[model samples]
Target: MPLLRTNTADKFIVDRRKTHRNSDVSRAVKHTRDRLSQRSGSPAFDRELLKLHARAIVTGASAIPLLVLVIAAAGLLGGMGGTILSWALVTVTCYTGIALFARSIDKADTARIELAATKRNFLILHSLSGLCWAYLASLGCGECQVEQFPVIKAVVLLLAMAATAIIASSLRGALVATFAAPVIVYGVVGARYWMPVEATMIGLLAISLPFFAYVAGHLNRSALMLLSFRREKDGLIAELETAKSMSDEARRRAEEANLAKSRFLASMSHELRTPLNAILGFSEVMSNEVLGQIQNTTYKEYARDIHDSGRHLLDLINEILDLSRIEAGRYQLNEEPVSLLDVVEECCHLMELRARNKDLRIVQQFEASLPRLFADERAIRQIALNLISNAVKFTPAGGEIVVKVGWTAGGGQYVSVADDGPGIPPDEIPVVLSAFGQGSIAIKSAEQGTGLGLPIVQGLLAMHGGEFQLNSKLREGTEAIAIFPRGRVMEDMPALPTLPLRAVASGGRRR
Candidate 1:
């Protein structure tokens, strides 16, 4: 067991040394790969890199004066005049370089060549600055009085190394060079003039060198990752903007096409109605044999078929025109005080014959106290007519449909049409409400329609600040409701009294 322990200890020591050695070279290799492989080719990236270095230079320039004061106070300057001159030269050069580089990056466009040159110049400046700090830390201690505190000198040197590690961390190459140059220079000097206590401290400093490099490498990697993420976000935003522009263009074209179609339909209304009226008139006469008796009974039957088909076609055309007018925003309403009962009763009466034809029953429930509505009379008629028509059409043979007109709990009036038919699926409610969209059951039923009824109802109600709702479940039934807002409800007014005839005559004579 002891032999196994010794072998394990030896392996651990070797692995640790290997890690340290790899860390020393890892900074340079990783930095080279990061720059060469992930070259963003963005001018903004280059500009940002320049700005980071400029900030570091400016920060280092600020610390120079404070560092000089501390060293002078500690009596660690080997030659005070020489040390002060060197600090002034380095500080002035660093500040000047910072200003010039920052302005250059701002004013000049950054190309590939310019970016490479900037990186090279920055690395050189950072290396020279590191050498100056090394000189101050190593040779500056030559004239330190033996009585002066050694801890102060050590503190100043370590602090300078730590600050460099932090300040130059944005660029991996610059960070490694800045820290390594000073440490390597100092290590050589310390080896040349070694003492018992100082040698131990120097050895410790050497051991910590690789750790600082590793930290700077991690910082650089994090910065690159952040930049990459930002670039991707910007690209995504650009793509969304392009998509929005294309969508807007497509929508505009669709509107133009719809407008053209509406205009064509409106123009053709006169042409269509004139021939249709003539055909309906002539066909009805022939079927009834009003002018003369028909020799062949088949002629009368054919005339009846022609008349029915023409009437149905005319109804479909009228519906298409009405929907077009509503869609084009040209359907104007003449508002008036209208009785809801009158409109609903008239529609139910007109649809009664059609309901009887299909052997379906329509039940009418009207609230006697339901208030009048201030709305377009013709529009109300159309709304009721369309709802009753749909109910009668969808309700199965021998099925019942209910048409209800009453005041809602919210003090508004509503018209509801419910039928026992193959109801719409919940998901198809929206589809049925859309223009020219019908439910699957309605499509498969023998009586197919143009499918514009519900949408027309919805649009008209919307114009009156009202709402439309469709509630249904498959294989059960469907109820469509059209509600008017409270504002549209017309309150009842008291009737004015009339005076007696004799009193009115006496009053006129007195006047």
Candidate 2:
């Protein structure tokens, strides 16, 4: 419930509630639909579509048997490879029927392989019927004992051939799974020779009827199941997409509100600063005797209160402005040639009054040979001032604060600000660098701040393609090392005009 963060928090809560409601409703609907689909034995597939496939399987099966028998009869008459050729044709017909039936049955939620086998099984009965025919027709009058083959001498031989075909079919596919081997074994032995050609062939077909029926029924059921689920799947996907669009719109509105919040902070802060500075400035002048003081201690006390209140308000305003500038992406730095020595001297000078007030000693060691860093002078000063101020604010009275400037091993210069402050633990380092947070040491130190200074320094450093690091211990000291690339800070040198003191003080950021 922080002021700036309140709107985002509210939106997040609302979004969560909406998401939960949608999820609950979707779950309930899916559960009901799924239960209904499972309980109803109603065909999920289109009746017309499944009927089309059943028609094809039954029709082709009935037709192919006759053609294969004729072909096998031709083999018996004069063709040597007639049986094999007929078998191949029957196999080819089975495969073709499976391929065509697969497309039609597959429109439903049925298992593809099982349906394919069902179609093939429907066709396989054709070959068996043909085998029965060949054996029966070969028993022509029993006069021609073709090749001295006894089984081929009578119409009664149909049973033996039929049993052989059934056993062969049991070699693979669902037939092996559905029919018992012992049944084929017993049928071939005792019951095979007990019938004439016509009776034996017809009986063989009757025995295969049950297996054929099971395959057909399963194929129909699978196709219907697939179709039913297909409809449900499409419906669920559409619902999900609609929900996603709603969630995206809500997110977009939340972002717009956040942007508006950033704008409000920016405008209000700038306006507040104009009057805040006047209050602090005139208070300073009166306290310094630049304005004649009234001869009363009460008046002096009131002036002190006014000065303190104004300064505190100014600090709050500055934090808001810097944070808002970063949020709005308008925090541009002024690039100029800056001497490292000068930057260190200026930051130290600014922090000296604050340091002396707390009896803290800030020791600076400036390198004379430090090169001119090409970057924003204002940013460098801000970074240095914030770091030095942090160092002074955290270091205990009578402890040392060491500020050192030199070139790093790389071309970039290194400015290290160290202090014998109550230091940050390794785990707490990242927490301090986070926006709106401070180090454990800083929080417990003599001065309090808005927890913005380090983040501002880090942001300004990133603008220059520079880097910074911190090294410290729990009780020893903390060191902030800043590295700026060695080049002209301003590569695109726009002609800069010399500014008067009042304009510089008014416009350029002082802290």
Candidate 3:
């Protein structure tokens, strides 16, 4: 019974886990979709985007200083030495300030971040960086004749614009804020030169600025998508943790209830039996007139009725206790070698008078030469008694019951009791097998029962490593079979060959 309870609890946990997992996934998906709908231009999204931008800035801070050094070296080779070197110093200082600001923002708590004020400050700093780049772009190499300087300046501006687009992509307008001034300054200065190379550089800057901005916008959307996926994952993990906690709570409650039931039954066994025994004993004495003859016939009849009721109540109590013990895995078996045929025959004989009173016939069929089964004798007797009594109780007057004990095809033994009673519906079979559960037919029958008989029989059979099956149709009778496995069938062993006593004595003398 404990095993059955554990299995039932495990099944429920598995089913509930699947159900909750599906619900959690659906809820997470719906929540993500709703957030996505309101994502663009929302204050909450802006704060998150700012945080991403800060993290990106801090991560690439080292690379920015290296790129500035390389650009400074290239400008010196082109003979734009002093002006280019001064711009590099200012650029590095500006980058250092931006990196420190971003680091502070990244280290601050998320809830404390003011999106509007922080975004305004970030754009102002980026514009300063853009003015530095503009200064570098407008620098001219007048001392040396370097025709490739225009190409070098254009390439440097383009690389810087692309880098800004990538690093500040999470913030919506950071790319435009950084490069818009540089593009304008470069185009204005190049138009002054009026040469083919400068004109081409101006046109390229004009086109590439908007292109990089568009690329940055796309990257920002990708970051939002990535954030949504991460939120959903965190939500799922939280849901699973909640489900596990609920499952543990449910199992704990079930265990507590089971323990309370066992304790109640344990206490009830003595509390109910003591009074019932007194009732039965006194009622029997009054009904039989053991002490003195009862003068009133009505009083005697009343005493007899009391005795019968008490006996029935006692039987019900016993059956309940037996079932409780079996379910709690406390029913101990006193195993012995016993004959299945003899057990069934004794049960039929005990139930014979009850069947006779109802004018029912119980036909017993036994297979001869059956082996003794190694099982609990009392449990086997109870199994046989329960089956036979159920048949006699339910079988209609003049209806015939067939009791058969025979070998199974697997060399095991089985006791089958079939009755021509009002049959149970197929759907109610499981209900009938449960403790304290009765089918409609059993409820409507003239003799009502506590409904623990078949359950007790099944429990006993399970203890013996056996099986119980009930077959019935609506109009046809019900057949109950209790099968003992082949392992429980004690087969006879062959005798060993004997040697002569004189030869043993002669061998002992020689030794």
Number of the top-ranking candidate, with lDDT as the measure: 3
lDDT of 1 by residue, 1-511 (tens): 0000101111011334444444634664565445445543456665565666556655565565567566654442544556656665674566466556655554554443366777787787767766666665465344544533333445565776666667666655775555566566666765675765557666666776677777766766666667666656665565567668978999999989987887789778878889989999999999999999999999999999999888987888888888778767888989999998998999999999999999999998888677789999999999999999998888889999998888776788889898999999865666777767888888998486878888788778878888777777788987888888899998888999999999999999999
Candidate 2 lDDT score at position 170: 19
TM-score order, best first, reads 3, 1, 2
Candidate 1 Cα outliers beyond 4 Å, as residue runs? 1-79, 94-111, 114-121, 141-167, 184-219, 422-431, 439-445, 472-477, 493-511
Give the whole-model CA lDDT for all candidates, comma-separated.
0.73, 0.60, 0.85
Model 1 local distance difference test score:
0.73
lDDT of 3: 0.85
Residues 1-511, candidate 3: write the lDDT tens digits: 0001111111011334354447766876687567556565777767778889999999998776778899989778867768878999999999999999999999998789998899999999999999998888778888768887877888988988888899999987888888888788888888887899999888988999999999999999999877767766766677678878988999999999999998898899899999999999999999999999999999999999999999899999899889888988999999999988888899899999999999999998888779899999999999999998898888889999999998887788889899989988976777778777778987887487888898899899999999888888877888888888999999799998777999889999999
TM-score of each: 0.73, 0.57, 0.79
Instruction: Order the candidates by lDDT, highest first.
Output: 3, 1, 2
lDDT of 2 by residue, 1-511 (tens): 0011101111011334454456776685777487437522333332333344544444444443444455456545644454545554754465455445545553544433354355365446444434433433333323333442323322223332333233223122333322333234334532445455534544554465455445544554555565557657766776678668988999899899988887787677778888888988887777666767568877677777899989977886786677667655788877667787888888898888888887888888876666577778888888898889888878888777888887666556767888988888876776677676777667766576777787777777767877777777898888887777665332335678999999888887764
Better of 1 and 3 by TM-score: 3
- Residue-pair clashes per prediction, in order, are 0, 9, 0
